[model samples]
Target: PHQKTVIDVEKDILYQNDMLAQRNRGYFDAKNVLAINLVSSPGSGKTSLLERTLTDLKGEMEFAVIEGDQQTTNDADRIHATGTKATQINTGKGCHLDADMVANALKGLKPKENSVLFIENVGNLVCPAMFDLGEKERVVIISVTEGDDKPLKYPDMFHSSTLCIINKTDLLPYVPFDIEKVKLNAKRINHQLEIIELSCTSGEGLPLWYSWLKSKVLAPEPV
Candidate 1:
């Protein structure tokens, strides 16, 4: 019965996490905050994308960031450099940020009403997929240099994510990555996944990303 015990413990953990996530979701709803969880592997350019996003959208909307890392606050520092309020959650040995951690961070972040809260999850495409941190939307980024078959390799992450960001497109000419192949592979895993190709350096396809964010904020569904 060891396997059964392990399964039971896993279920208990998820059940507790789900409860906390619902509480977190309710808090976000009460504050009218649009929370987006950004997940990806290391060097996927999540920080760069957020830096640009906060910079370009400055004076347009109130924004806050919860940067997750296993150790340093470097990412949060970078985000703060953009003049956006940011809190770093050092997960220590944990590979992923759970609902409890996010709920605790929320107390300090205190993102204002009608503002956007971006949670840059730990740079891991594995464990993050199983934890729901009470986000209204989830974005997964994969750099072109990371190969085009990421969707097939990390099906859980791609399947759970609502949007897939293909970053580092400026190097596409040099890389053997096929953008269309990535889209097709991801779609095969998740037909509803919205894909966007962007280059943080060249500022290509960013307008569409911004427009998508605006539409989600302006037309948020009932909580």
Candidate 2:
């Protein structure tokens, strides 16, 4: 009886979140906003990538950001420094940003039509995978310092993400990580997962990332 109750509670919680996620998806579709959820473990360079993207693409496209963290507003502050609109959501004891939190944040963000909205989820590979923030794309980022077996260890995250970014490639010479092995592992989890290897510090492979973003934004809406 106890196990059944726990499972029921979990299902109910997920059901509620899924309904709200559908609403969020509708909102984004109505506004033609391309919302992308950035997920990763701590120190994975998600913020660095966002800073670079915002700085390099400034003036070309309007962007808004929602920074999610368990404690401080540091990430939001960094995003704001780039002159882009950003709102911070401190989850406190919560591990992930749920659809309701994002729904509330969207009220203040008011991302422009046809603009890109980046929701930087809390640096967690586990809990965040289960929450859908109504994003058009979910990107998983991993740094070279992290082990190549991350995809296999965090299969849920790898299975859920649409794209996997291999960041901090500049440290490849110093780290023991294997790029090909990581790609294979990620592919094993999700064969359709698009992989992009880049070094935010060195600007390597950034253009490809930029092009991918452009392609998504420029793609015609589905009928």
Q: What are the lDDT scores of the predictions, listed in order?
A: 0.95, 0.95
Q: Candidate 2: where are CA atoms >4 Å away?
A: 219-223
For model 1, residues 70-164, the per-residue Cα lDDT tens digits are 99989999999999999999999999999999999999989998899999999999999999999999999999999999999999999999999
- Backbone atom clashes (below 3 Å) for every candidate: 0, 0
Across 109-162, the per-residue lDDT of candidate 2 in tens digits comes to 899888999999999999999988899999999999999999999999999999
- Mark the 10 consecutive residues where model 1 has the least summed lDDT: 214-223
TM-score of 1: 0.97
Local error of candidate 2 at 70, Å?
A: 0.5
